[model samples]
Target: MKQIIKIIGNPKIFVYTLIWLMVLVVLGTLAQRDIGLYASQQKYFSANITWLGNIIPAPGGRITMVVILVNLTFMVLFKHNLWKIKKIGVLIMHIGGLLLLIGGGLTAIFSSEGNMVIEEGAQSNYVDDYHNMELAVINTSNEALDEYTVFDQPILGKGNILSHENLNFNIEIMSYLKNCEPLKRTAPAGIQYRGMLKNFMLSELKPEKENSRNRPGITYRITNSGSSIDGIYGIFFGQSVSQTAVINNQNYEFIIRKKRTYLPFAIELLDFKKVLHAGTGIAKSYSSEVNLIENGIPRRVLIEMNEPLRHKGYTFFQASFIEGLEGETTVLAAVKNYGRLFPYISSIIMSIGLLLHLLSSLPKLLRKIPGVSPS
Candidate 1:
């Protein structure tokens, strides 16, 4: 057993394992082989899933496992022998890289992202936009504190949603399709047919074919107090309104299509500034002045291309630019990641290791110098 332990704990074994990991990563990346299409001037794969598929299949190359294993091996091989060092900067940078990888893994597992678009003077209580899958809670009551109805169906197959006290009816997720345009369908008999739902709608009933309708919306019906209101709502990039229905004495409708439950708070863009290099029409940099209203207090924020504004366990990144009648607005995408601290820890470790490695080598080199004194 001692021999086996030695073999498993050998530094050479770690090196070999690292080499195999590199080989697999290279092969996995190469398996996507569409250089011609990748190099073309015109691009088409805009959706995240499509892009993911093009790079790595559903099984996802299995390279992540290799990465985890290699990192673990390195960590185990050098438990407490990482503090003796010389170059602090190099050590910090190396550790920073490892931290970044750990942060990335955490982001992949527990990060939530989405969008919320409001009219010039409108106010949104939820983040209606999305870059990935999320769980949303629709609050219907028009009070200071409204009751919420939660939906956590990541992929559409078979799901049942419980009705809340504020909502008139519960929701059932029959099917879900990504990318493809959904086909419209007629509602069943006895169930009043609502208007056609589009892009982002919740349906009271399932359509015939999952992807038949190119609509990325939902359609669901409910009867509150007695007045039955059934209609289809379409949610897209631009400004659009849902058909109003008076159910019971209170009106029950889906106003915004956003993922709200996971969010800690909200961010509103109050103003923006774009700077350009003089004498050359090229743009230099841009910044967005936003109002970060959290816990009932509003704070001014500035978010630039590379510089991000972080608050309340969420990081707001300067994702893109938008030019509109409001005198050029900047778009800042919000990201909420639970594993942000891991990067800091790993960065410290890697930095210390690198410094020790450098310092340990430097003394030997200096001693070997031809005329060097032992002072």
Candidate 2:
């Protein structure tokens, strides 16, 4: 531990880490041309180690960041001699940098961002994740309210058996295609295949540039379920219908859709207003007039591009609008981040540190000037 600390504490390691981070940025940008932005970022910037063709391994952005963090921490605490009179400004600057890093860590871990779409006069309480898929088993037996049990992407991997305490039966996954295409079946399938699966077959397709555009499909066999309700089940993204199962005298529908985050409050779109650039179809600005309903109470608020509605740590911004035959659909980009104030706070701290450091050195600078005397 002592040897490790000494190596990280060395001033040269900080310089090396910065150089490595710059290299990562350049390489990651270039890699985006081939593997796309999301893929490149995941491999290079997100992961702790980047593998080259399943053989060679390289240090990733996270690893470099950790190194820099450790080196900076040592520099601030030990090397600079904490609580020194003359080094106060430098220590404050280091503290600001440390705070920024901590904020980044918080954002990376606790942040949630997604989109909420509400048509004119419609209300929605959930936001759909941009890239992750979720298997929703909704019990529609109750007339009053439906019960939803969701399985996130981690459990929906290929060949995984899904069994929940709330669910009566077990689901044995046969295939889970990341991107799939559904086509009309030429021949009739067995009795086990039901619903949309009977008439259509899902095949693998090349993934789309936008991860959300990729329609994922799942094929699974129902087990521990009786003969009537047991069979091969299939579901896919954007499927209008779902595979129905009767368990314990309750009707449950299984559908694979984008993961949803249900918020405490709901947003009802009252009006969608847009202004076009002069003589052009492009929108200069767009805004959504929505009723923010919380705890059975409604409050009118306008969400715009520049001015976003922030409530209870969630921020809703007017991202885009879709024109439809019935009504206009407003897409609100919702973000909930614990570290939202970190950047601004860190910037202020850093600025104060820089100003203080400059002022502290002003006397020496004045001494160097032959004509200027230190008062």
Candidate 3:
């Protein structure tokens, strides 16, 4: 254990780790051109291990950071010299760095960001994820409100069996494609097939550079459904209609879509106004006047490119606009970050450390010059 501490807490290890982090940054940046920014981030930065061309595995951005964090932790916990009064400023600086690293980890794990697109005069309470997808099993039996049982991207792997106490049957995923399309079939399907698969077959497609453009699809088999409805099924993104089923006399709809996070408050687009630049059709500034409704109470606010609305930890910024036959649509970028204040706090701590360090060292240098007293 002592040997491990010595190796890990060494200044040499910290220097080498910084060099490795730089290498990963360069690798991730170069990969973005081929796989797009989001995909490259997921594969090379967010993940613990990155597979080179889906083969050779290497430590990723997250793992490299964890190593650096451990090194910092070991230096603080095992090194006794840092605890002395003379080294307080240096110790504080290290503490600030440790806090910054910890804050980054919190942000990576707990932050949620998505796009909320609302048409003029329309209200929405949900935001769609930019990259992740989910299989949503919704119980629409109640006319007032629907219940959602969502299976996220992680566990939707092919050959994986999914079951729930809330669900009457088991789902066995046959095929799960990152990007795909549904093609209508001329001939009828066999007795074992059901839902959209009865009318169309899913065709695999190449993923788009823009992560949001990719339409994912899934094919699965329903077992122990306790009805003639027990069979194979398929669903895809933006399908307009979900594959329906009757389980335990309750109506259910299964659909695959960009993961939806239902917000506590609803946003209604009251007005979408954009101003064009001089002598050009391009938009110079755009804004969305919205009503943020919470528990039946409405609060009006304007969200613009430079300005954003913050309420209950959620921040909404006017990201872009889309022109349609109906009118203009407002796309609001929604972000909820647990570590939003960390950078500010860390910077303050570092500044304080720097100031304290200067105060501690100034007198020592003054004694060496001319006739300053050593006492």
Best by lDDT, which number? 3
Ten contiguous residues with the weakest lDDT in model 1 = 39-48
Q: After superposition, how far is residue 283 of candidate 2 from its true place, in Å?
A: 2.0
lDDT of candidates 1 onward, in order: 0.50, 0.87, 0.90
**What residue runs in model 1 are displaced by over 4 Å at the alpha carbon?**
1-24, 27-104, 113-129, 133-147, 158-168, 180-194, 197-215, 218-250, 255-258, 261-268, 276-283, 294-297, 326-328, 337-351, 361-375
TM per candidate comes to 0.59, 0.93, 0.90
Error of 2 at 275 (Å): 1.5
Q: Could you give candidate 2's per-residue lDDT for residues 74-174 as a string of tens digits?
A: 87867746568666787889889988988887887699889999999999999988778889889899999999888898888778999888888888888
Pairs of residues clashing in candidate 3: none
RMSD of each: 7.8, 2.1, 2.7
lDDT per residue, candidate 1, 20-79, as tens digits? 546545544563354332221112221112233457542231343334445544544453
Q: Which one wins by lDDT: 1 or 2?
A: 2
